[model samples]
Target: MIKIFTTIFLLIIGSTGFAIADTDYQLHAELIAKNTYVFIGKKEDFSMVNGGNILNTAFIVTNEGVVLIDSGPSYQYALQAKAAINEITDKPVIKIFITHSHPDHFLGNQVFPDASIYALPTTIRELKTNAESFLDNVYRLADYWMAGTEVSINSILPLNSTSELIGEHSLRYLFLKGHTAADLAILDETTGVLFTGDLVFHNRAATTPHANIEAWLLSLDKLEQIRFNLLVPGHGEVTGNISPIKQTREYLTWLDVTIKRSVMDGLSMNEVINLPVPEQFQNLAVLKSEFMRSVIHRYPIYEKTLFEQIE
Candidate 1:
């Protein structure tokens, strides 16, 4: 009886059995390429509007099994994502690669406890320091959807940084230090899909609470040289062309320059925060709020630099 009722609830949420219940998090997925699928999240922060479904998580169906790029926000969302993957294929998820230590990317680690979860040692270390606190924040912000969730650390992540084989598929791992203290990007050579975790936000303004803008810009230059036909960003819709990366580059560059200019002018942080949105970036998703967040994150460093120059 409970199973039947849950199915009915899932159908009502338009999950078609992908979602476990009609909780606040209603996960919906779409196929971006052959054997490649991604969950489209709201281009906003974790809030009631989207119910914490604000990060893109993807999986590539392989001949041997399924390979999940990053888990979703909570244990419940991970369960929903797993169900969604099952809806498309019967293969059990054998390997999970974390792109970064962000809460949205790894909180669902418990759902795939049986699967091998992989990440850089740096990523694992960062998660070790911040995972519990980040999980607590998520639980408070998205309480209803996070009722049964808890942080699950991947003990195997520190084993190595070498590339792994998923059946016959070869996934190349690139360790990058931008967007966060430790960020890893993956390229599925079989499908030509590059999963750039938090490093690139398509149409949405990126959250830079943990970013090194200079390092991020350098990473962008390297990303431009990657040969891929499809890009599945950490947030926003998937794209066939690399325009999204170029667009992200523009926004990041603009923010970097704008912050420096504000500091050079000796402008107060409030002044920088209140600056009008750039005409080029006005149309992007979540501009105002995210721009302010970026200023708040980056202004301190610039202010400190100015103080040193004065002294």
Candidate 2:
């Protein structure tokens, strides 16, 4: 009796640990329409781990198969994503669309080995050139939060055209080069869903590390011309109206104006970093303390001006 009780106790403890591990990487699937669904990942805060807060992954699926927009950071995430899709449909994932070369968006490419991977030429170049350092950084800062997984890099499909048809839907790929050289925006004409990647952040603050502030503003203008009822961002919740896109544009505009004024006044990057957001923007949900730091890090106006001076 003692032996049996001990064995049962061990099994219960093991099961409990497994359950906790599963919850650590929470995955949620929401049906957006009749045949389409979005998979959102809930993982530990990546920015705070190395860079701010927790992160998630979003993808669109259909009956024919899945056309993934972005892959999450870990192989485990990919596996979980695969499982989530399988739960809804048994068809194979036919194509994978990578919005950019960011690890949070493309590291899970290994999971869809048979699918044709699509990306911008510049995106492919950055992944090839900096993948090593990117992985190193993830391991260095977010290893504990990564769920012990690795992904292999392979070939990627290039897109120089404006649009491509995936399944029964037509996805228009627009080149908006600000956040990254090859940031692609997908517009589904049928569903009126625009997968804007990082081009437009609804409530969240937009990062501009590899961004061109002037070019970004122009891209925003172009996006305004296009019609999209649903805007799916790289981070944050989905938006139904054009207000988020407009808000993102306004934020960038404000940043540009503020930075330019500071530059004219000869204010230092450190000074700009210490500066706070205006009282007007403080009411916005995504413009919290966490995003303020990201904005400062990404598009440090003083840093750019200093670099220009050095050059």
After the best TM-score superposition of candidate 2, give how far the Cα of residue 12 lies from its true spot, in angstroms.
17
TM per prediction: 0.90, 0.82
Give the candidate number with the greatest lDDT.
1
Question: What lDDT does the true structure give each of the candidates?
Answer: 0.82, 0.69
Task: Give RMSD (Å) of candidate 2 vs. truth.
Answer: 6.4
lDDT tens digits by residue: candidate 1, 1-311:
44345335555666555444446466666887778888888888886445579989988888989988888888778988999889999999988888888888888888886798888888888888899899878766765566467788945466365576777778888877679987788887877889989888999998888898889888877888899979888998888788888888899889989999998988888999999877878888989889888898799988888789889
Report the alpha-carbon TM-score of model 2 versus the true structure: 0.82
Among all windows of 10 consecutive residues in model 2, the one with the lowest summed lDDT is 47-56
Candidate 1 Cα errors over 4 Å, as ranges: 1-24, 154-156
Question: Candidate 1: worst 10 consecutive residues by lDDT?
Answer: 1-10
